[model samples]
Target: SQQGEEDPQALSIQEGENATMNCSYKTSINNLQWYRQNSGRGLVHLILIRSNEREKHSGRLRVTLDTSKKSSSLLITASRAADTASYFCAPRDEKLTFGTGTRLTIIP
Candidate 1:
């Protein structure tokens, strides 16, 4: 298992519903970060959780880190159609190593 590999490669949800995505990594890390990408554009940083932290939140996004399990999850509350995008988790070292993203689609 490589660092920052996301699960359930794709997801579809209706507007106002919540979306959750999970990422698992192989090695110990200093920090884990989540990002969102619309279409082919650049990634937008959502949240970053340090290995010492258990959870964090920003806006409608909630991020959880479980260092013991080497996993992290992202939760998006009250999802909107505009929230449709590809989400990724990356492990922070000297540089970030991003895994394949999970594509989320919000239906109207």
Candidate 2:
């Protein structure tokens, strides 16, 4: 399977502003998972929206998947300093494909 990559590679925004990141894949997937890794912490599972689902939300986070476009997007509302982390998306399969991820900086 081909690895999907995150768009914008990096983003910076004020603490209270919303942040959005896009991920695009090369092949079909069963499900797509989103993750966040703080400076020194392990990747934290954020959202796992399936191929049949269009949107899912967890707290201030929203995930939208458009299988037709073979793409997904992650939106973080009411961002905070703690939101400063690298976000990654992976496809659920026997061989998982996860890209480098998008680095987000929240300026206080």
Candidate 3:
């Protein structure tokens, strides 16, 4: 599988706080994307940053990619209970492989 591995199988944060998660892949990739899954639902694309890019931000989401280290990090600022969900990072390919994911919980 081309899927990368992510740390912190679960995370609990309070509302208005921040959450961070990391991911590491084995092979090189063109781009990496962060997705959020609510309970037993489909994944929602949060952000995507190419290998040529170091960092990208969207609203409360900030993502950083390091090709040399084959790793990436996602940061969510001022998190809310509505943001509670599992986050998975995957490579941008025809067959996208997903990691186990980080189960995030935001306390209200």
Judged by whole-model lDDT over C-alpha atoms, candidate 1 comes out at 0.91
Model 1: lDDT of residue 85: 97
Model 2 misplacement above 4 A: none
Q: Per-candidate TM vs. native?
A: 0.95, 0.95, 0.95
lDDT of 2 by residue, 11-49 (tens): 999999999999999778889999999988889999899
Which residue pairs does candidate 1 place in steric collision?
none
Q: TM-score of the candidate numbered 2?
A: 0.95
- State the lDDT of candidate 3 residue by residue for 1-108, as single tens digits: 489788889999889999999999988788999999999899999999998999999999999999999999999999988999999999766569998999999999
- lDDT per residue as tens, model 1, 1-108: 245889879999999999999999888888999999999799998888999999999999999999999999999999999999999999776677788889999999
Question: What C-alpha RMSD separates each model from the true structure?
Answer: 1.4, 0.9, 1.0
TM-score of 3: 0.95
Instruction: List where candidate 3 sits over 4 angstroms from the true fold.
Output: none
lDDT against the true structure, per candidate, is 0.91, 0.92, 0.92
Report clash pairs, candidate 3.
none
